[model samples]
Target: MEKLLTIKDVQEHLQLGRNRVYQLIKIDSFPKIKIGNTYRIPKREYLEWIQNNIGKTVFL
Candidate 1:
């Protein structure tokens, strides 16, 4: 099992606004786990996703 991150964590880590993080989450391939009314991002998968998407433009 890996660490799970909150949306706030992602926002702070990426220096992005809450709206931007939410926009990324709306993307089909973004890694996320929805539990009840909240969302958790798998730490490893999030890192991998960033690496994988480098040099690509993401649009919400």
Candidate 2:
């Protein structure tokens, strides 16, 4: 089964602040899903994003 991650999970994985995560989503680059007021990200999507941005500086 595919893994689903919460905002906190993404923050922990990326070691970023809550605001930064939101900013990434706002920029439409981060893999995220909005269910009402909550945000969830698929583990695969997060991994893909990491791979896609590899070698680039991710300013958080």
Candidate 3:
């Protein structure tokens, strides 16, 4: 099974706030899934995105 991350998890992992995470989610390149009203991020894809976008400043 794939590991899933919640908004709070993303916040902690990225050292960002809740609203910042939500803002990132609005960006087209952000890797996220919306199920009902909750947002879930796939750990693998999130990590991949980070690796691929290293040094790129994400403005949100």
Every candidate's lDDT: 0.95, 0.84, 0.93
Of the pair 2 and 3, which is ahead by lDDT?
3
Q: Give lDDT tens digits, candidate 1, residues 1-60.
A: 799999999999989999999999999899999999999999999999999999998877
- Which prediction has more favorable lDDT, 1 or 3? 1
TM-score of 3: 0.93
lDDT tens digits, residue span 1-60, model 2: 888898788788879899988887785788887889988888998899989999998764
- The CA-based lDDT of model 3 is what? 0.93
Q: In model 2, which regions exceed 4 Å deviation?
A: 58-60
Regions more than 4 Å wrong, model 3:
none
Worst 10 residues of 1 by lDDT: 51-60
Cα deviation of 25, candidate 2, in Å: 1.3
